[model samples]
Target: MSINRSVENMAKGGMSMEEFKAWVRENIDADEDGKITKDELADIIRRNGEWFAGWKARKWMRSADSNRNGVVDEIEIGNLAEFVQKHFGIKIIS
Candidate 1:
């Protein structure tokens, strides 16, 4: 495996949804539902997107926590975001 991918995978071993999503973004570009295909995965990694640039880009994608239970929305987006920010320093902007 490539160095970046190896590191990303290593980080993912203990990832939550937020962290997974962030890793996905830098390492993945998933669609609205957070599902990724093999082709898309290849395309994303090939582009050389780091696991996290730590940039506070402007965006406010709907929370993956769809249930509104005040906890990950019963999804992985928040968790993934947290991980990305914490490990890679990629800031999440609203």
Candidate 2:
């Protein structure tokens, strides 16, 4: 789906936390590497029309990359929902 459409879905509270995570994996993982990188995270934030996307992405990476692997994998992805909701203003229904 287009980033705009994904953003619209999120803004409409049409996704649960699990669905949001899947959305990020599907739509935001630019490289399709099964992991979310800092750049990808920043891009998603920017797509959402947020200011300081880069900085916010960095903060989120720090908070969510539990192993400090420099990327968020499936295990770490769950940590991002709260940050996404809080920082990106994306509503997570569950």
Candidate 3:
């Protein structure tokens, strides 16, 4: 599902941040590698209905990838979540 749809679902279901993070891992981690790459992040942003998905993804990746390992690993997901909330208006109940 798209990120916007997911957010709507989350809002309707009252998901916590932890649950939303898990949802990202399960749904957005297309490679199933337990990490989110820039491409994957871009895809998610694109799915969120952003016309400038690539640019937004690059910005978010740069901000969230604290380790500079070219991927957002588990530790960096919090950063990703914050960015998503701030930029996409995704509200996590917790």
Indicate which candidate wins on TM-score: 3
8-91 per-residue lDDT for model 3 (tens digits): 666664568788888988777998998998898788778777688888778889989998999998888889888777766666
lDDT for 24 (candidate 1): 60
Error of 3 at 69 (Å): 1.1
What's the C-alpha lDDT at position 36 in model 2? 89
Stretches of candidate 1 off by over 4 Å are 3-17, 25-27, 49-94
The best candidate in terms of lDDT: 3
- The candidate with the higher lDDT, 2 or 3, is 3
Over 17-44, each residue of candidate 2 has an lDDT whose tens digit, in order, gives: 6777667767789998888899998898
Please report how far candidate 2 places residue 65 from its true position, in Å: 0.7
TM-score of candidate 1 versus the correct structure, residues matched by position: 0.32
For candidate 2, the TM-score is 0.71
Worst 10 residues of 3 by lDDT: 1-10
* Stretches > 4 Å off in candidate 2: 1-5, 11-14, 88-94
> What lDDT does the true structure give each of the candidates?
0.44, 0.77, 0.79
Worst 10 residues of 2 by lDDT: 1-10
Clashing pairs in 2: none
